[model samples]
Target: MMTGDAELSMFPADSRLFEDSFSAENTYRVSGQNITIHQYYCANLGVSASVWESALHLCQFFESLDLSGKRIIELGAGTGLVGIVAARLGAHVTITDLPLALAQIERNVACNTPLSGWPSGAPAVCPLSWGRDLHRFSSAWEFVLGADIVYTPETFPLLVDTLVHLCKDGAVVLLASPMRREHGAQDFYSRVLPEVFEVELVQRHPESNINIYKATLR
Candidate 1:
């Protein structure tokens, strides 16, 4: 149940959510700046429905926060839309997903960002496989961002493991997802995430089915 404005914030100037296919380009406009992202709709290689509704929720969250100069890393970055926005907002951002998504993420980052838009230049793209690849990154981030990532049941444990290793002690972590629990994601995340970090539910707006959580290491 997204608000009208929230739904509009999900796409760019000329974007259509359900026309053609997910491979169609998506446009996003924020604070007078514009960005376009391309998404591959295939899920077999670990890519799923291109852009998600929770991403819109996260974008709104970005507008409300002061992320200036923060070291931010986004796990499960699909099209890198949120990370691109974070970089554009003056954070040193790194966007990661499975290895297959690296090239597309890179392309989106490039297409959406101008040379002058990113205060710290472009976002770093990394191929992350959760528990198996936690060592590739230094565990010293000021903030970690995730959107629509808490969906798969089998990946839950590894996702938590990666989150624990990425954030510094007491670092802020923000995660958002639609309360779709068909695969048992809601149950697992709500139960286990608090074990490693102190968690609080963030109320963004009244009508969103998307749930946002604010957590910090204990």
Candidate 2:
């Protein structure tokens, strides 16, 4: 059974989630670049089809960084917004999600193709189930990104393992998530994550109840 906060995190309080069927093309201005994302809201496709507020907050946070030429990868990149923004800011970004979620991410990536400052055109869309296929990815990334991915308690171990694998070379890990108490976000950040990485709360948006954390291999 999903907790109230978990359900709320999965489905935003906005009325749009109740629509019979809908898709939205929302535009965002990040790092002086305008990015338009196409999002589909369907119960069948699960939470990966919609854009989360944590993603927007993370994109805003990215504006403060110099991402030029940095090798970055985003895990559970729903709608690929954060990765797209990073690519626009000159980062070579790879966006990954579950296999079922890749099509939506690919469409969003394609919609924003030829992102300025991206070395090899659009960001690469890949399937990455945490704790699996760890060998396929190298530990050479400069940054690892995730937005609103730490809600479920059952996935904590897998997610931590993936983070350890990716940040083996001291790559910085940035995660943005809502403070969903019932969903175990606090425990994950305070207890589980600290066991593996040295974590720091870099930014917090009170109005949105979102916190951005920066972690590095200890």
Candidate 3:
């Protein structure tokens, strides 16, 4: 029941109820920007709004910077919202997610296709699984973006390795997530990334209920 320029659908189990509950589709309205993103189904292995909000703030921060010509890649792009916004803001952005989630991300990209104006090029949607190879998207990007991707101690090392592998030296790495569960990811970044990355807390959103962080290659 999403009625707009976007003919988006919902997951079967959650679709009917969600459609009936809200008169309009839910969207993230980025501050200081005219762009907005609409999400339909959150996929099976979904990320929360706190993550999305944090990513939006980080993206806004990126937009505020001088990135007229820079290569960017977004990891764990559940619905491609952050990547799309980055592309619109003139970064050569590549969107990656689990293969299973690629279709929905592509759909969301297509949904906002007209609005996303990357003069350099359109953002490429690629498959990238953590702890796996990332050669297809190339090994160079000025910045690597991730939102709500860090979770579970088991995946921490691999995520770090992946980031280090794909990002070039001096590349800025941006990550946003809500501190969830008892996972040691916060500690891992605090302890480990300093060896390779200059980590900094950019924004803590109590209103949006998320924490957005920025890290740069050291």
The best candidate by lDDT is 2
- The candidate scoring highest on TM-score is 2
lDDT digits (tens) for residues 98-169 of candidate 3: 665677667666666554355667778988766565456566788888876766665666578778777655
Weakest ten-residue segment in model 3 by summed lDDT: 4-13
RMSD for all candidates, in order, please: 8.6, 4.7, 7.8
lDDT for position 157 in model 2? 83
lDDT of 2 at 169: 85
* Model 1 clashing residue pairs (backbone): 12-27, 12-28
* Winner on lDDT (1 vs 3): 1
Q: Model 1, range 32-146, lDDT digits (tens) per residue?
A: 4477888765433233337777776787787778878988999888889889888888889999986667888998988877766678768999987777776678887988999
Ranking by TM-score: 2, 1, 3
Candidate 1: C-alpha lDDT: 0.75
Winner by lDDT between candidate 2 and candidate 1? 2
With a 3 Å backbone cut-off (N, CA, C), the pairs that clash in candidate 2 are: none
Q: State how far residue 108 of model 2 sits from its true place (Å).
A: 1.1
